[model samples]
Target chain A: MNKNASRFLAGPYIIWMIGFTVIPLIMIILYCLTDGDGAFTLANVAAIATPEHRKALFLSLGLSLVSTLICLVMAYPLALILRKRNVGQGSFIVFIFILPMWMNFLLRTMAWQTLLEKNGVINGILSALHLPNLAIINTPWAIILGMVYNFLPFMVLPIYNVLIKIDDDVINAAQDLGASTAQTITKILIPLSLPGIISGINMVFVPALTTFVISNLLGGSKILLIGNVIEQEFTKGSNWHLGSGLSLVLMFFILVSMALMAKYDKEGEGTAF
Target chain B: MEHPLIDLVNISKTFDNTMVLDDLCLSVKENTFVTLLGPSGCGKTTPLRIIGGFEKPDTGKVIFDGQDITNLPPNKRQLNTVFQKYALFTHMTIAENIAFGLKIKNKPKAYIDDKIKYALKLVNLDGFENRSVASLSGGQQQRIAIARAIVNEPRVLLLDEPLGALDLKLRQDMQYELIRLKNELGITFIYVTHDQEEALTMSDTIVVMNQGYIQQMGSPEQIYNEPENAFVADFIGESNIVPGTMIRDELVEIFGARFACVDKGFGVNRPVDVVIRPEDIDLVEPEKGTLTGVCTHLIFKGVHYEMEVTTPDGFEWLVHSTDMCPVGKQVGIHVDPFDIQIMNKPESEDEEAVGVNE
Candidate 1:
C-alpha cells in the first residue's frame, strides 16, 4: 500500500513542477522576446539596456556586493568566536540575529524607519546628548545596514558549522610544529574554512541583489534598485515582459557567481587542516 | 658520564580532584629509547604530554638539558609528539606537512627542502611530496607524521601509540622500522604503549605502570624474569600466581606440597605469593617427578601448546610446551627452584611479626 501511494505521489509532483515552474519560465522567455504592443521582437530586451535600467542594474550589483562584503567581515569573526567559546551565549546571540529575521520584513523595515527618522529615537537621542542630528534614513548606508542586519545569519551559520568540525588536533599539530598562532590560522584554519565562506557569500549576495523592502522603507523612495525596478514594471506599469527579462538577467548573474563559488569549493578541498 | 637529556622530577597532576600522576619521577639519558608501558588509564600518555609541554604538571619540574621547561607551551619545548591518530593535516600536501616546522623556524628554502627530503627518506616515504594526505594509506600517513615531527630535529621525540591503528602484521613491521629509525637518528625517544611485547622488543628501558603509579622500571629481561609485584608479573606476561608459605630461605610450601625456590629474607615461615611462568614449567611422566597433575585443557597456539593441569591438591597450573600434552592425561610438572618468584603477602599478623623482628 505504501509503495502504491508513493507511486501515486511521484506522478503529480512531476506534473505540478512542470505546470507551475517550468511552464511559467517558458512563457517568461516567450514574453521576453515580445514588444510593448505584444509582437515578437527583441525590442523589449533592448529596452532593458536603456540608461535608466542600466542604472538600476548597477545599483543592485553595487549594493549586493557591499552588503555581502560587510556581512562576511562581521560574520566570519562572530562564527569563529562562537565555534571556539561559550556555545550557549553563541546560540543566544544567534537567536538575537534570527529573531529580527522572524519578525515581518515589512515590520523590521518600519522599525528601522522609526529609529532613523529626523524626530526618531536616533535623532532624539543625539539631540538629547547635544550632538548633531544626521540625515540617515534616505541614504545607501541605511539600505546596506538593513541588508547586513537581515542577511548576517545566512553568512554566519555556514562558516560556524565548518569551523566547529575542524579538528582541534590539526591546530595543535601546527603549533607543535612551531607554527605560531597567526600562521596556524592563516595557513590552516582559513583555507579549511573557505568553503563555508564561499557558501555564505553566495547565500548573502544573491538574495540581497533582489531584496526591495528595506530599500523602500529606508531609502525613502529615492534609491532605485533592480528589484524595485522589476516591481515597478510588473505592478505599476503593467509590463510583465520587461520585469521577466530583468529577472532572467539577475538570475544569470547569480548562476555565474554560484558556479564560480562551486569551482573555488572544489579547489579548496584537502587544503585545510 | 654526561647528564641525562630529560629529567621529570616528582611530577604530579590532578584533574577534577582525581590524581593522574602521583609524584612520578623519571630521567632519560641521551639517545636512550624508553617505553612507558601500561594499561589504559595508567597515566602513561599524560606523562608524555607533560614532557612534550602539551600539559603542565601541578607540582614538578621538567628539566631538559638542565633547564626548567615545566611552564613552556608545546611550541617552545624542544620535543615533538607523534599522536596515536597520526594527526596529519588533511588539507596539506605531504611536502607541506613535513616542511611545516621548517617553515615556522624561517629556515632557508633550500635548507627546508633538504631537511624534508632527509626526513622523508628516513621514514621511507620518499617521493610522496605532492600527494595529498587523504590519499595515503594508514601506514603511509603514519610515516608522514613521523617525517613531520622529525624534520625539525627536535631533541626528543614522543610517540603515543603511533602504530596502534595498524593491523597486527603491519604493527610488527612498523615496530622494526621504528627501532631502525630510532637507531639511525640517535634521538631520545619516549614511547607509550600497552603492548608488552612491543615494549620489550623496542625499549632500552621499560617503565611498567598501573593505576597511575609506576610498578617497575628495568630492562626487558629484568621485567619479564623478575617482576616486582603480582601486577607487574600479570601485566608484562602470563603467570600462574599461587598462595604459598615461605617455609625456609629457598623453599615455599603451596597446597600441602613443598616447592624449592630462590627468594629469601621474608622469614623462616611467612605467607607469600609465588609466581611461575607457564613456559618455565616442564612436564614429565606422572608419579616420576616432584609434583603430579592431570591435564584438563589443551589449547594449540601456533608455536606452542598451552595446557592447564589440575594438581592432586586441586590447584591449577599452566604449562606451555612445543609438544602438545593430551587432555585427560596424568602429567608431572617440574619447575626449577629459581623459576619461582615469591613476594611477601601484605600485612598479615605473621608478616607483621616477621617485619617487627627484621
Candidate 2:
C-alpha cells in the first residue's frame, strides 16, 4: 500500500517499456534517418512518393476503409440481435463468436485461404451443386474479406457491451413517448451507443490498415499493401531503413486514430472487456 | 355517470407460472388522480404498464376511451409514463428531452418550441432548455421527465412511483406540484406507489392492492374510516385489529367486553375483526373506561406518544395519545362508537396468507 512499494511493483513494466517500446522506436527513427553508408539521408522516407509505394499506401487505406465499413455494417446488427437475446455473459451465443478467436490468428487466416482457394471446399461445394466455378482468391476482395473476418469481433464486442448497458427503462420511456421502433433506434439508441461505435471502428480500422499477414496469406504476392511493402523491405529486400520509415508513417496513422479514439471515447465506455 | 376514461376489465397476468394479477378490474374517471397503491410485487405496475401499452393482460381487455387497445404497442397508445427511475435520455438536452414526443409526432418546429416552453414552465424549470440531462440533479431530472411526458398532451399520464426517489420533503413538495399540474392540465393521472400517506394525500381514488388483488378502492376518507377487511385496515394505518364477536345490531364483544358500534350487517354471535385506530384510543382512569391495560412500552413519536398497552387477555393495544404514559402504568382505554369499525373475521390462515403473501 505504501508509495515506495507500489513504485517497485512497476519496476519490471518500466524496464520492459524502455527496452522494447522506447528503444525500438528510437532505433527505428534513427534507422529511418540514415542510409546504407550510415550517413544521414531522407531518401528512405521520401520513397513513399514513388508510384509503387503510393499505390500500396492508397490500396491499404482503401481496403482497410472498406473492411472497417463492412465490419460496422455486419457487427452492429449482430450486436443488437445478441443483446436482444438477453442471454447473459458465458452464454453459448457469445462462445460461438469467441471460439474462433481461441485458435491462432495465422491458423484462422490460413484456414480461410484453404476454403477460398480454387477447387477449395467452397468451390467444391459449388461444383457439387452443379453451379459455375467461383473465384475471389488472390484479389483485393479476398484481402478485405480476410481483414473483416479477423477483426469483426473487435467491432461486435464493444458495441454489444454498450448496447447491454443501455437501461431498459430508457427504451421503454422512448416507446412510451410515442417514438416508433425506427425512431427510437435513430434518436436514442444510435446516439447513446456512439462511443462504442467509434471505439469499435478504431479497433477494426487500425489493425486492418497495418496487417501484412492477412493480405499475404489471402491475396498472395500479387497484392502489395503498405504493410506488405514495408514487410518486404525488412524481410526479402533487407532494407531496414525503408521498412522503418514506412512503419513510422504507419505509426503516424495509428497515433491519429488513437487520438480520435481519445476524443470520442474519453471514459472508455466502449472497452470490450 | 359518464363512461370512465379508461377501463381495465377483468385483467389477469401471470409471470413465469406465478400469478401476478388475478382478474383485476378498475375504472378511472377523466381529469382525476387514481393511485394504484400496494407493496412491491403486488402487480400495481402491471396495470400501469398495460395502460401505457408496455404490458398486455393475459386475460381481459384494456378499454381506453371506449376503444380496445390491449394489443397496441406503446408507441401507438395515446398515453405516456413518467417512469419510476425518471428514464430521461442521457444523450439529449433538457429541451430535447421534452421535445422528444412532439418531434416523434412530427410536430412543427414552432409548435414544438411553444410546447417545450410551456412544459418547462409547468415544471418550474424555465431557462433549463439548453442544459444537458447529465448536468441536472435527480429532482431536476425527474421534473424534466414529467415535462417530457406532459408535452405531448396525452389523454392519460401513468406515473409509476415518480416521486419514490426523492427525499421526504421534496416528495411532499412534488406531490402538491403534481396535483397542481393535474388540475391545470385537466388530464387523468394514474399514479402508483406503496406509500400509504402519499396515496392518502394525493389520490382522488385509491385502489389498495395486496398479492395482485384489489383489497379495497375508495376515497381516502372512506378507506381510512371504513376498511373492508383486516388487510385494508392493517395496510392503510397502524390499526389495532383484535378478534371479536358480533353479538347483535350496534354491538360487538371485544376482549370479553361489549362495545357499541355502528356496523351490524352480520346477525347473531358471528366472529369479526374489530378495527380500532391507535390515535382513536383515549387513555383515562381505569375505573372510568370500558377496558383497561398496563402500559407495556412507550415510544415518543414526533408529535404524539405511542404507548403499547397489554390487556389482561394478552392482546396488546397500540395507543397514540398526547399525554405520556409511563411504562408499567395501568391505563384505561375508551373508544367512541363511530371509531369502532367491524368486519368479518378471516376465514382461514391460508386465504389471509395468500392475500397478503406474508
Candidate 3:
C-alpha cells in the first residue's frame, strides 16, 4: 500500500474549511466593499468613526482587556498548584475545572445573573444577614464578571498543560543553583510558560471582545457594545454591508492578537488545549 | 577530630508502601570523591537527594559540618547538584545559565562576567557563552551543567549519574575529566552510578548498595580483593565461586580434593563459599598441574583469551589466559594459595549478588 495515500483523508477537512470558513470570510469582505445596488463605496466601513460606534469599540476593548488581565492573575496560581500535585491528566480535579464547559455557556451566564440580581438567591441570603444587595446585575461589572467566569478555564487548561510538561528536574536544578522559590518562578517557570500565557490571553481576549450575548443578558440591551451594534445592524437594521464592515474592523483586532501569539509561540505548543 | 563534611545518619525513606532506603548511613569526607554504586532502584539516589535537600528522610537526620540540616530547603543548602539529565535552562543562553547563582546573589556585573568566563573555561567551553542550551550536544550540555554547578563554589557537589546519556567512549573520556575537576576544584563530590569501572576509576571511596541496604563501603582495592560475602564477590568481576568445606586452619577442600589455602577462622568442616578470579588461574601441562580439565569453549577477548574448562567431576571453570587452547584439549589449571578468597554466605535476602570491580 502507498503510505502517502493516507493523506487524502484530509480532503473532508479542507472542504469544510473552504465552505464554512474561507467562503464566509470572502463573502463578508465582498459585502463590506459593495453597497446594495452593487456600487462601490467606502461609506459603510468609514461609519466606524461615528460617535456611537466609536464609543462601543473603545468600551469593548477596555472591558475585554481588563477581563483578560484578571483571568491571567487568577489562572497562573491554580495551574501551578495542579502541576505540583502531579495530578494525572484524567484526574477528577481536572474534570471539575472542565465540567462547566459542558454546560451551555448561556445557561452559566444566566445563572450568574440570577446570583447577582437584587431578589435572587445571593441577595436573599445577604438580606437575611443584613448585608447590602449586589446591584451589579445590570452594570458593566456584571458583564465583566460573566466574561471572567466563562473564560477562566480557557486560560487555566492551557497554562496547566504547559506547567505539567515541565520536567521536575529542571525545577530542582534551579533550586540547586541557589535560586529561591520566587526567583525560580520569575526566571525559569514564567519564561518557560510564556507560550501558554500568550495563547491564554488570545483565547480570553478575543471572545470577551466579540461577545454580544453576555452584555445583553447582564449589562442590559441598553449598553451598546461594538458586538451589539454589529448584531443590531444585521438583525434589526437589515444593513448587511454595515454589519460586514464592522465585523472586518473586529477581525483586525483579532488578527493583531493572533500575530502577537505567533511571535511568542512559534511552535503552537500551547494551543492544544 | 574534625567532623565529616556531610553525614547521612540512619536515614530511611518509603514511597507508597515500598521502602526505598532502609536505615542507611554514610559519612563523606571533605574534598574527597565518593561514589554510590548500585543497580537501578537499589536506593542509591535517595541518599543523594537527601543530601541535596530535594528529599527528606522518613527518619534520621542529615548533618552538614556538624549542623543538623535535615529540614533545610535545597536553595538554602550549601550543596549543589548536577542532575542526571543536566537540566539546563532551555530559555537562557549558556552564559546566563552559568551566571544564575551569582545573579541570584546580586553580584556585581564585572564579577559575574569574570566568573562566567572562568567557569566556562574550566569546563573547556570558553566560547559557548551565547549559544542556547538546546543547541549543544549531550556532552556539551553535561559540561555546561557541571559549569553551572561548580561556579557556586559549594561545599559539596552531588552528581546523580551525570554521564548516563553519553556514549561509552565519551563517558570514559569524561570520567577522566571529572577526576581532574574534582582535583582542581577541591570540593567534596558524591557521584551515583551503576558502572563499576566508573566508580573504580574515579572514586576514592565506593559505597556498594543493594535493596535499600549498604553491602559494603571501602576503598576500591578492599572492595575488589576482600569482599565480605558471596554477593560482593560475584558482582565485582569474573569469578569462579564454588561451595567448599574448611577442613582446618589454612586448609580447604573442593571437588573432593584436599587443597592447602591461606584462609582461616572458619570451624573445621564448615561449609563456605570460595572465590577465585579468572585471571589468577595459570595453564600448565596436565601432569604438572594441581587440577586437570578439558577445554570446552574458547573466546578471544581484546586483551586476553577466555576459555571454559570442565573437569571430569563436572565442575565448570572460567579461565582468562593470554594463549588459546583448542576445544576438547585436555588442560591443567593451577591456583596460588593467596589468590583464593573465602567468604560467608549472605545471611539475608536483601544482600545477595552485589559486588563489582574494575
* Candidate maximizing DockQ: 2
- The list of candidate 2 runs beyond 4 A from truth reads B348-350, B354-358
Task: Please name the candidate that would achieve the greatest TM-score relative to the true structure.
Answer: 2
* lDDT per residue (tens digit) for residues A1-273 in model 3: 466676587778989999999999999999899899989878788889999999999999999999999999999999999999999778999999999999999999999878887798999999999988878887888889999999999999888888888999999999988888998999999999999999999999999999999999999977878999999999999999999999999999999999999999998878987
Q: Per-model C-alpha lDDT, please?
A: 0.86, 0.91, 0.90
Provide the RMSD of all predictions against the true structure, rounded to 1 decimal: 4.5, 1.3, 2.1
Worst 10 residues of 3 chain A by lDDT: A1-10
Candidate 1 C-alpha lDDT tens digits along B182-221: 9998999999999999999999999998666777899999
Backbone N/Cα/C clashes per model: 1, 0, 6
The alpha-carbon lDDT assigned to residue A118 of candidate 3 equals 74
Kindly report the TM-score of the first chain in candidate 3: 0.96
Candidate 1: tens digits of C-alpha lDDT, residues A152-259: 888887787778877776777888888777888888888888888888898899888988888888887889988898889889989888888888888788999889
CAPRI-style class, candidate 2: high
Candidate 1 yields a Cα-based lDDT of 0.86
Off-target runs (Cα >4 Å) in candidate 1 are: A1-16, A37-40, A43-48, A86-110, A122-135, A267-273, B312-314, B346-358
lDDT of 2 by residue, B164-257 (tens): 9999999999999999999999999999999999999999999999888898999999899998888888888889899899999899999998
Best by lDDT: 2
lDDT of 2 by residue, A128-241 (tens): 999997789999999998999999999998998899999888999999998888888889988889889999999999999999999999999999999999999999999999
Give the interface RMSD of each candidate.
1.1, 0.7, 0.7
TM-score per candidate, chains pooled:
0.90, 0.98, 0.96
